[model samples]
Target: MSRTIRALAIVLGLTMLVAGCGSSSGDSASSSASSDGKFTVGFIYVGPKDDFGYNQAAYEASVAMEKAVPGVKVLQAENVPETAESEATMQNMIDKGAKVIFATSYGHYEFAKNMAEKNPGVTFVHQGGLKGDTKLDNLGTYFGTVYEPVYLAGIAAGSVTKSDKLGYVYAFPIPQTLANINAFTLGAQSVKPGIKVITIATGSWCDPSVQSQSVKTLLDQDVDVITQHQDCTKTIIEATEAAGAYSIGYHADASSLAPKGWVTGSEWNWTPLYTDIVKTVKDGTFKGSKYDGDFRVGLQTGDNPFVQSKYGSMVTDDTKALIEKAKKSFEDGGSPFAGPVEDQDGKVIYAKGKQPTYAEVETMKFFVKGVVGKIG
Candidate 1:
């Protein structure tokens, strides 16, 4: 039997070559390798494919792979967690004769790596994994530099917040979440010098109930604009729409969710990475190497996946032009965290006239100058 799950949140936005920033899908029926030479690939996602963001993006990539590469066999099961269930599901793929497996969640990292090692003949690619063990010779990992676009979304939020206060609904407090929050705060401060951002961590990635409450809480306090780093925009978009506030969305395009109040957002284009891996497998040149897809490969490049909706009439053409210029500048060696940074505790982290390096931005851990509340 096969099932579907949606994992991860997809941020949405426009196509500009900015410096920073950054599925599974499920299979319906079991199948064997293709009669032709193409190999069979299996994808495991942590959430439902219909979840409308992370899972959907990965599923879309698998579909695109099928369309682009004739005779390639692809199977998927959605909502498979990183717990014990992953071991069984991954084993099922191996037993079913999957030549390569793509585990598209952070939790699946160790599980997939272990299985890949146990089944040395099968190739595995785990997204967002950092593995130091040499036992996994068949495993590789890849992730995007998403902090770049999050900063850009912050710029939109910063420009649109009339109250100089912004709200964010976070899923977890890991390094990834912290980096995203920092990028957003920096973007807002680019336009409004001391914009205050309030953050609420719902702990779980796909809890609509809790996410909605967090957004509503912020709105009740008169937050004019909202942004989110959760897997779904159900809470952020719903609360913002109910309160008649603007929102910047993540993962996939959510402009339709808040048609009138939508601004730009951040996104990850999985197809470019997916296509490259599929091609590598086909060409027999694939190796177990870690890769970070970003502006260099046009993966997170143009306007196809990321788009800024012209929803708010208040969004000026000048603002759009400024965003374009900022993107260019960042790509041309400008850092998103360019100095005078402060945490939620009012202590200075990066001094004035100092800029963060790529490694520093990638490992970001603190709040910036204008975020209103603590990470918790």
Candidate 2:
């Protein structure tokens, strides 16, 4: 069977199995007030909370939610794999009095959707899944326009690379990942024309060994700088400290991971978004069907969904100034995928004097010029 068909069949089977099991006692508990009149929030992670990347960012936001929202109890399940086991983990959290659950991984989408259908009283939030709002009334999906900060980081990478050949260790070739790679390349090229980005797809998001090997492979290719789109800081740590190469990071501030070789990177400040979702739930004003959390608001309205880490002292002042200027342009409605952009085959994807819509960007599948790799 084709990959898409097989994936659909799996999701269908899982949904049927979960719905058959139905809701348990905890489903009722979520609707009732606790002894202290506090509402409980639950989070499910696909990787360890201390991975210092994606999960760490989500975990920190959960912590911030607990502190910012009074009478709120937070429950979290760490290292939950993105398989059928994730449904069981969600059930455990629901049993423990969680009214709302956030499944922070793309692979967790089907499990969360099935659970939402089985238990309508509980709210489900998923990250990087497009079907949540359409699949169920109680399910919502959210993601940031991470490309903005990624583009900014590219400026740093482009400036620091001695060979003008940078390497990117990415997990998948999906639209989301491809968009980031394209943005990073474009950003670098904007600062240093003719910069070439060599990419390696590891096929997994959180495998440390695989990421380490990819780092070594890139370094061996004479790449002086590396960046990644995975679930951990292993790439940054391995590339900078071990390989002695400059690195950019994703998901969280990993400057401490590399120290001397650390350049600026991108971060997701999910505090405001999480807080707003929780408050909406509390006020009974939550609209899952209409809630599509975006990073554009964070960038333009100061909601702070996207953050650029402080430039390392190693970064020259001129490069930092260029990044800052680009950041302001994004805030002022500028986009990284503006017209005059070309794909790998030298075909114009966006004509000059035009900008791609958010939907168009989300569906991006081709790499721009100067990027060396094929997506499957």
Candidate 3:
């Protein structure tokens, strides 16, 4: 079933039977266990395995992890809801002999923590979630500095936009989403001064209908270029091909989806991250402190967590030069949230020689100037 339909079914008090629910006890002699007899690694996905967005990225990483580690067995449960069923899914994996579990969704935080507490033997890693006051020893959070690459994509969009008006289709109004929007605007403004960005919040993560309608709304407003911070490539494909506008993508390489107007986009190379995590678990170095495994990496690091896809043939040389220069600056510790930043209300949030801390940026609430939308 589609992710949106499954979510609605979950909310409507329906008991959805997941495949492979009552397979084996995971300790069976014929199970797919490594030769070294280590426990299995489990991954819980919030969407389908082929969504070509968030879930696909994680699934691809898991496949890479399996190949990297010899004799390793990786189990996965797709289309898992973020409600109580999340805890149940983890339990099912545990029953099937999974020892290290990764929950790849923000809403799975509480359920993951609960599972960790109940199954102290299992290690839990949550994407885009922190183990706050719960202080769970076996739960940690990890995410990439996606804003860095989004900034570079913004340069491409800025260089190509004819109307100087760009549109962004977003899933929610959280701090993470806001940071990307602000960074994209800042990156565009750095190249094409006074460029305006129009944003639309779909309020749902993977609804193609809502996303398509949002793109239509932006196109009607004369937005010549469109990008997104969403869980699907529907916006990029529909905007560039159907609406005849420039496009940028997220989560994965979507250049194929927008042949006509594909510029460049931010992609997550989760192979390195997943391989490192699995190695740590295999080598007995895995820990579960409140913040033990809280990790963040981007382009500057040797591990290519955040990357810019190959520029489409239509991208200009000037835009490529600008992106390369900005990337070098980021590698040298420069940030998009540097001083002289202003809020949507024209209030100077950062002075001429100041910037926000990492913690502050992670919880950013206000939109930067030059952005046209309310956080609803």
Question: lDDT of each structure?
Answer: 0.72, 0.81, 0.80
Candidate with maximal TM-score: 3
TM-score of each: 0.82, 0.83, 0.86
lDDT of 2 by residue, 115-158 (tens): 98998989888877776126466778777787888998998999
The residue pairs in collision within model 2 are none
Runs of candidate 2 with Cα error greater than 4 angstroms are 1-33, 132-136, 206-213, 288-298
Considering TM-score, where higher is better, how would the candidates rank from best to worst?
A: 3, 2, 1
- Write candidate 1's Cα lDDT for 1-376 as tens digits: 1222222111212222221211232234256645556578888888777777877888888878767776677878887877877878887877777878888888998888778768988888887766544555567776665677777778888888889889888887877788888888888888887787888888888798888788889987778888888887776796787778988878867777777788777665677567777777766666643331211221223332333334356678777777777778766666666667777777988888887754466566777766765654
Pairs clashing in candidate 3? 137-288
Ranking of candidates on lDDT, top first: 2, 3, 1
Query: Higher-TM-score candidate among 2 and 3?
Result: 3
Residue 101, candidate 2: C-alpha displacement in angstroms? 1.7
> lDDT of candidate 3?
0.80
TM-score of 1: 0.82
lDDT of 3 at 229: 85
